[model samples]
Target: MSYTLGVDIGTFETKGVLVDASGAIIAQATRSHKMLVPQPGWAEHCAETDWWGDFVYVTKALLCDSQVNSEEIAAVACSAIGPCMLPVNAAGKPLMNGVLYGVDTRAAAQITELTERIGADLIMARCGNALTSQSVGPKILWLKQQRPEIYALTAKVLSATPYLTWKLTGDYVIDHYTAANFSPLYDVNKLAWTDDLAADILPLDRLPRLAWSTEIAGHVTAQAAQETGLAVGTPVTVGTIDAAAEAVSVGVKDPGEMMMMYGSTIFMIQLTALPVRDARMWYAPWLYPGQHASMAGLATSGTLTHWFRDQFARELGEGAFGVLAREAADSPKGAKGLLCLPYFSGERTPIHDPQAVGAFFGLNLTHSRGDLFRAVLEGIASGTAHVMEVCRALGTEPVRVLAVGGGTKNAVWMQATSDIGAVPQIVAENTIGASYGDAFLAAVAVGRVLPDEISVWNPVARVVQPVAEAVYARQYPLWKRLYSQSRDVAHELGGGA
Candidate 1:
């Protein structure tokens, strides 16, 4: 039986999956890694260790567990957290650790500088996105200015998936979906790189060739085959960011279909017939040509829950997350009047404030751990609601919201998200997420399956209906106010250091 291999490198983990022609997963494996925070407002990952190392380990493990012949693998595909900034030398060795996505706020100054210098209105018109922490253009400028020696030696600037593809195929390329995040450098209208905006950031040659997500990048090299335990001639498709792949995994194909990824961060992607430009949200080319996507993200979501587990629930050990979920379930709908802002890494979408801070307001001595945890979940839900509000305001509202990723397992978080957002979320059966999606994309690339067959591959498992809770309606506004009220103090604290 023909099979496909898929791998995804995420913020805190890497996952791999092997699936047969029938779309049944034969084997799956995962490896965990740390997100390095060198300083406040900075997040990074070691490309050599966390990315390539995980890829090798997971691929080998999946092959061993599945007992699939290496020659039977038709194709390989990958997706990962992006658009990250990782400069590499001539031999494709990482010059430094990869700068992470919207969570990393180290380039805030560069964002502002570029916005003023290039004209914000022009940037929005040309790039279809405003300068924010999510943009990779400013990060490129940051490296050039802050670390010129490294910049001088840089051969190519790549994101997570592109880096993996380069390792696998020895081809420097990026999918358009991931390339759109390199704002000011990519012209959304032209659907190509713009030399005018990129002139100051770096030479256009430093960028990789652009392709669609399902297009084959190149065959795996002999060296890559040796490292990955795959055939040298195995085809590797041009890969995309994890969120886009996750959207594809759950059948978010036609316009008005959306996917809300509840991973380390909360990312929302809604397919659109045409580019929908809004300063509040991002616009990008979808995985396929002639398609558009409206996107939004929160700086933190599941990451906040992880922090709570590590800091307060150490005794729970392996059961920390499950226990925390139960504790949060016990807490009342509105967390007993406590409110939180999940801006731990600064706010994204709508506000676009990199200096924004996280806070638990209305906290009293009477509150318990359950209340705090519940507040955290509700806070993230409120943020999701805000994104939905913006999407609706911009005329890109989704007819169906498909939920995926690790956070969907948390009943409290999922329920709160649906309740506070006032949107019913459909959970798919195979929400193993981006890695699974990558496998499907690989199959499609090699003509093993059609794009429309995703429904047969993984159907809707269940739906999380929005609860008509008056408390949530009342508290969401306060959640919005918490950030506004605390903005000045938060900025002071952020800058004081």
Candidate 2:
């Protein structure tokens, strides 16, 4: 039987899957890795070890576990945590660690300089995005200004997915969905790379060739075949960021359909007929040629929960998250008047404030661990609600919200998001996310399935309905004011990073 192979490199882990032509999973595997915080406000990953090494390990594990023949795999695809900036030399060796997405705020100064120099209106008009920490152009400029020695040797700037595609197929290419994150460098109107606004960042020639997410980039090289245990001529498709793939996995195809990814961060992608031009949201051409997408996300979500567990629940051991979820479930809706700002890794979307600080206001000595855990989950839900408010103001409320990811397993967290955001969420049968989507895209690349067939591949299992809660209605406004009133203090402490 024919099969397709898929792999995705995430912030904290890499996962792979082998699926038969009928969309049945043959086997799956995962490898964990760390997000290197070399300093505060900076997030990085070793391209050679963390990105590619985890990929190789996961791919082999899937193949071995499934006992699938190398030649039976029809195509291969990958997705990764992206718009990452990783510079490679002439021979494709990484120059340094890859700078992560919006979570990394090291390029804050460059973002400001470029916004003032190019003007925000022009940038929004051309790129459909404002100068935020998510923009790769500013990070590129930061590298040139702060580490010229490495910049001088840079032959090409690649993101996580492109780096994997290059290793597999020996081609430097990027999907338009992922390329849109390189703001000022990518023109949304033109649907191509442009050096018009930021010529000083890097030469246009250094960027990878652009393609749609499902397009075949190239065939696997013999070297890659040797390492991956795949057929030498296996086709590899140009993949996209993990969020986009995760959206596909859950059947977010229609214009009004939205995918709410509850992963390391709470990322939301809504397919729109036309580009939404708000500076608070992100816009990109969808996986296909003619589709469009508007995106928003919190800078921290499950990551904050992890931090809480590591610091507060060290005694709970490896199953701490499940244990914490139970504790949170025991707490009342509003966590006994406790309020939290989920800006542990700064803020993204709506506010775009890199210096935003996290806090737990209204905390009292009477509160228990259950209350604190519930407050943390509610804080993330509030951040998500803020993004939903932005969408409503723009008149693009989602017709349906498909929720997927590891966080979906936490009943308390899932209920909190639906309750706080006041949006019902549809959960698909398979919550494996991006890797599964990559496999499906690989099938599409080789004409084994159509895009709309995603519904058949993974049908809706259940729905999380929003229940009106008096406490959430009351606490959300105070949560909004808590940030506004504390901005100056947050900025004052920014220098510590």
- Clash pairs for candidate 2: none
lDDT of 2 by residue, 1-497 (tens): 39999999999999999999889999999999999999888999999989889988998898899888888899999999988999999999999999999999999999999999999999999999998999999999999999999999999999999999999999999999999999989999999999999899999999999999999999989999898787899999999999999999999999999999999999999999988889999999999988999999899997899899999999989988888888899999999999999999899998999999999999889899989999999999999999999999999999999999999998888998999999999999999999999999999999999999999999999999999999999999999999999999999988654
lDDT of each: 0.93, 0.94
- Give the TM-scores of the predictions, in the order they appear: 0.99, 0.99
* Stretches of candidate 1 exceeding 4 Å from the true structure: none
Candidate 1, overall lDDT?
0.93
lDDT of 2 at 47: 92
lDDT of 1 by residue, 217-332 (tens): 99999999999899989999998999998998998989999999999999999998888998999999998888999999999998998998999999999999988889999999
- Candidate 2 residue 419 Cα shift, in angstroms, is 1.0
The TM-score that candidate 2 achieves is 0.99
